[model samples]
Target: MPGSSLALLISPRHKVIHHDGREVPDPTKNKAVMKELGKWWALLKDKRFFLLVPVMVGFNWNGTYLGIYLTRYFSVRARALGALSSGVAATAANIVWGYVYDIKAISRPTLAKSTWVIFSVIMLTLFSW
Candidate 1:
């Protein structure tokens, strides 16, 4: 019964539709084999997927450095408390934003770009000293 409100907002059950608009069963096997890993290389060779690598890395790098630099504004115990508060804030943000996005309070693509801009501003404010 936990998360039932979220469940009611969105159904986990859905038909899988292919790119060609055919409804097909999802693959039962979740694990990928080494042989199948070549598909990623093929994608990169064909000039796909690789473009996302930088975006992924940029977000991670920004978050890591953001934490590091933010802690500089605090003493030892203050840093620890700041980290704790930051973690709690992150959890609250995730739950609230997940619910908001699930209810279409904001469009997914717009939310994504907005978060990027917000984080960039936060980073600039924190680290531009």
Candidate 2:
């Protein structure tokens, strides 16, 4: 805040909108309602949320466990290179997925679920081998 030319604080006089699309009468109410949404989305809106949420849970859990496996299976140098390659591949995959979803108008949930299944199969095959 010391080096900023403009004032860092919001004045209490300003009006803002609540996340739920209601008007906050003054700046004082803004801080309380600035969150993305006041309530969680009903899963009924899109059936996909139910599936994607579990996939996300599994991804987080498996990813943490994967670090231990990687360290145990590979040499220090191999592990480092694997990490680098994985990062690059992940970035590339993200870009491709984004482009395909946006430009191609693909169904996001179907794509996500199918990809997860395909990857899981590949993982199981590799682990078994």
Please tell me which predicted candidate would have the highest lDDT against the true structure: 1
How far residue 65's Cα lies from its native spot in candidate 2, in Å, is 3.3
CA lDDT for candidate 1: 0.69
Q: Where does the lowest 10-residue lDDT sum fall in candidate 2?
A: 34-43
Per TM-score, the best of the predicted structures is 2
TM-score of 2: 0.51
TM-score of each prediction: 0.44, 0.51
Give the per-residue lDDT of model 1 (tens digit) for 24-79.
54456556777568876777688545545555666677779867877777678887
Candidate 1 all-Cα RMSD: 7.0
